[model samples]
Target: MTLFRAFFTLSRAAQRQLAFGAILACLAALANFGLLFLSGWLLAGAACAGLAGLAAQQAFNMVLPATGVRFFAMMRILARYGERLVTHDGALRIIGQLRVACYGRIAPQAPAILHAQRGGDLLARFVTDTDTAGQYYTDVLIPFIRACVCGIFFIAITAIFSFHCAITLAVALLLCIVIAGAIKARCATLSDRLSATQSRIQSELADTITAIGESLSLGASFHQQSVIMQCQAELSATKRHLAALENGASSLIAFCATLTALCILFFAVKDFQAHLLTLPEVPMLVLGGLAAFDVMSPLPTAQKTLAQVHRAFDRLEDACFSNTTAKSTSNDKAFSDYSSLQFENICFRYSGQEQDIFHHATLCVKQGERVAITGPSGCGKSSLISMLFGFYPLQSGRILLGGSDVHTRTPEDLAQVISVAGQDFHLFNGTVRDNLLFANPASTEEDMVAALHTVQLTDFLATAPNGLDSFVGDEGLQLSGGQAKRLSIAQALLRKTPWIILDEPTEGLDATTEQHLLEQLIAARPDATLLCMTHRAAVLPFMTRVLRIQDDAFCPSEEKKP
Candidate 1:
């Protein structure tokens, strides 16, 4: 989409605030130009009356009319304040909307798609792209509109005084716009390079930060630091080149505008000397033309802002349309139940890879049945579970729930039926209850306590003073590893879906705790289907069947029932 269309697609609140901000900015520019013209007229009128040897009273009367000029100045100040207020308000609102849109679009994307994208790269897009899009409305679009309005008004006023001056101003304005456009065209290549470099730098920075401990342990801190400096230096060089381009363009435009103003002044003076215009009229006309030139001074700066806008637009375009898989499909239903799951000849491969992760993988789980899957690392165990949980698309197979294909179901419909607790659990910084009831907002305190109890967390909660209301630090940092894992399982249990897929559910727990937690889980949801990935053989007796992922194929173990 074009920049303006994208801008208008922002939330209505932001659009309305931006519209008000633009109006205020235009009014401010008008008042500023009006004040300048009035001041000039007052000076010329007073000079003529004073040179004619009028009395003090006459001089005072001549200059008294300029009092209205002060009023315009005040109005200009107020308009400027209003413009700033509205602009910032609009900017912040747009920032929020852009962030929401970016994340919302990325959330439902297939895991294969997300896996192909680097975490650091995605973070940069989320933070930097949203920031740039916000500038499109605040600094570029609104100002451009205001400038056009003010430029036209100033030219009209100048026309009444001297048509030559008006024509000269118009030509200068047009040249500035044309040059700005050319600069924008030229900067396109550089802007894209800069944006890519920025993404790389952000990715490197995130990696460095996340691996700081590793670097230290490996005695490679110096090497990582050098790499970080290299990225920083590259970014600095890119920005320097951008700055130079802007400065050069600004200088050339300023020269052209100055030459145009000088030409207007020369013609006006010559016309007056030849008695082609009255003396009072010459000063009035020259002053008005000069005032118009003053109004054009900010045009070059606006051009620079426009260039930034172009850069921002390109980033936004990438965010909105780069990977089709990132777009979220419509969700018209809510998650409520999970009764059964079936996978038939399901196939999938990682992007840019030749080998398929899952080759004709097939499985079925009846209601209340508990199945355990065992596989070597990287044998598509997690990938298979992700597909089962609607986190990835099958390459050439069908996933069904209650005899219906899952692809035909909305996200909410899938959500209502299946819940998953993956190995890499994420917890928001909030109270324990907040993390537990994340899926169901209407879950009561009783429900929260029950879930905690099922996860064997009631003993810990009772001693924590705050119980379910206890604050878990960022990502549940304050909680022990076992506690964090149990919390994630508790969240899934709280959803109360018909199917629960747990990946490494007993990881990081003691042998006793693992067994106890597994028993509690089995007891808590006697009617729910369970797909658990585990390596511990002790839990095998509790499972109804075992599926082994061997040689990239899912095969049932040969433990036959009598």
Candidate 2:
């Protein structure tokens, strides 16, 4: 019943569509039962009539019974085909809605979610989770309902021949249903384990491929290959366990079905001898009992699917119903006018670590200042910048941008005041023009060309094929290191916000290129506040003021003025 709740979360239209598919499925099951019973009834009746005499066969009038046989057969075929068509369409629709819902839920949690999971794992959730969540309703729920409908109808029709015989068939069918339910519950854990393991293996394989170029460059290719192989072996072991359980349950269902059919046949023979049922109808009861059991075949598989559906819903619910769904009540006030950037009594640390990366830190960068922050590696310089931009919750203090509390302003509002070009900004698999357009979709070609010129890439673009329309491959793999870093700078400059935060933006560039680009950024955006975090000191002479991070606080640089 908990799994069934996942269905109602869809829109009413989708629920109705799925219900229609189930109705068609039930009709198809009944048709199958009707076709089997009528065929046995017709053939046995014909053989008995012919044995008696050719004239008796002529009197029986075979046309009506033969027509009944054909009717049920055609109905079964049509209904089954319609069921498949409608159910698949409904399933596809549900998958699309779920994809939208999942993305909507996870967007707020962003890099926070990525911090808890590998990017490949999130990618797998986007793709695989949506596909499996619908299977619980279509393959399992619909089929189970169809079997119940067919079971009841078969028993009711059998009662017309003899009340006592119907009671016997009903008991046998209920027993099989109970046993299958037990098997399904027993194997449920195995199904859940298999689903989880399968997803991990898929994510691991994807991560392996994405990082292959890096691993080979680091001369750690064999280490990466070993990790992938271990994951594959564990996945294989889980699959084998699942396959064995399913096979065993299927075998149990077959045994119970055979035993039930034999019991029904025995009762039918006894009824015939007692003169309570006709001799011609005996084969109909025997074959009809076997046909009744056919409807129960999906029961075992349905139980296995129930387990898998539970796992998928758990993952989806974790993503969609996460705590991040809480809406921010912060004001949407933008900081257009600037006086200074200030951090007062700032304290910060990662979520599960005790030591604060920065405790009681304070600094001020006056408006329209070009400041560079330099520090040793892993000294929380980037983390401090992240807090300044409102990327995460502050530990115990406030960050004021243009005198507004960073926590009190929304991210969209902050975007108007600040733009960041990080060391690891992504370039999607798209055209150079498309990537640039992401910063501002309404930007004209003239604005784009000007941004490229500021970053000193205009000459390179003039000689390149496809120019702005050239594909960047995945993560801009086709570009050289310097080209990728310069493109990122070009994107940040296009924002033209009141504040620009550059984290190691010129790392891959030569000294002349770095100095030229930094000088251009300062000249063009003389009114904008620039905060650059860099390891290299080549671009420092162009900065208006330089600060060095030491002992958990920002202060004037110890080095000589550039």
lDDT of each: 0.74, 0.78
Tell me the TM-score of each prediction against the true structure: 0.90, 0.90
Among residues 3 or more apart in sequence or in different chains, the pairs in candidate 1 whose N, CA or C atoms overlap within 3 Å are 335-416, 336-416, 337-417, 338-498
- Candidate 2 clashes: the total is 0
Error of 1 at 17 (Å): 4.8
Residues 1-562 of candidate 2: C-alpha lDDT, one tens digit per residue: 4324645677456777788888888888888888888888888898999898988878987899789889989999999999999898998888787788778767656554447776666776777877878786787788689788888998999998867668877987787677667766656677666666767777777777877788789988888778778877887887777777777767876787687677777778888899988877888887787788778877877877777777787877766565531244456455665677788988877667898878888988887888888899988878865676555566777877768676666666777777888877899899889999998888889988999898888877897789999888788888888888888888888888878888887888887888888878777778888888887878677677888887877878965546
Show where candidate 1 strays beyond 4 Å: 2-4, 11-20, 55-60, 274-284, 324-339, 463-466, 559-562
Return model 1's CA RMSD, one decimal. Answer: 3.0
CA lDDT, candidate 2, residue 539:
65
Candidate 1, residue 199: Cα displacement in angstroms equals: 1.8
lDDT of 1: 0.74
Predicted candidate 1 versus true structure: per-residue lDDT over 1-562, tens digit per residue: 5544656688475667778888998888888777766776677667777787747436456535577788889999999999999898888887887778767666666464566666788887778777876776666776568767877987887777677777887888777677666667556666677778888878877887878899899999899888778878887987787778777767777687668767777766777777765555565555555555444555545555666556666665555455534223445755333466778887887667798888887777788888988877787767765665556656788887777777676566677777888887899999998887786788998988888888889888999868888998988988998899899998998898888888888888888887788788888899888888877676677789888887667788754321
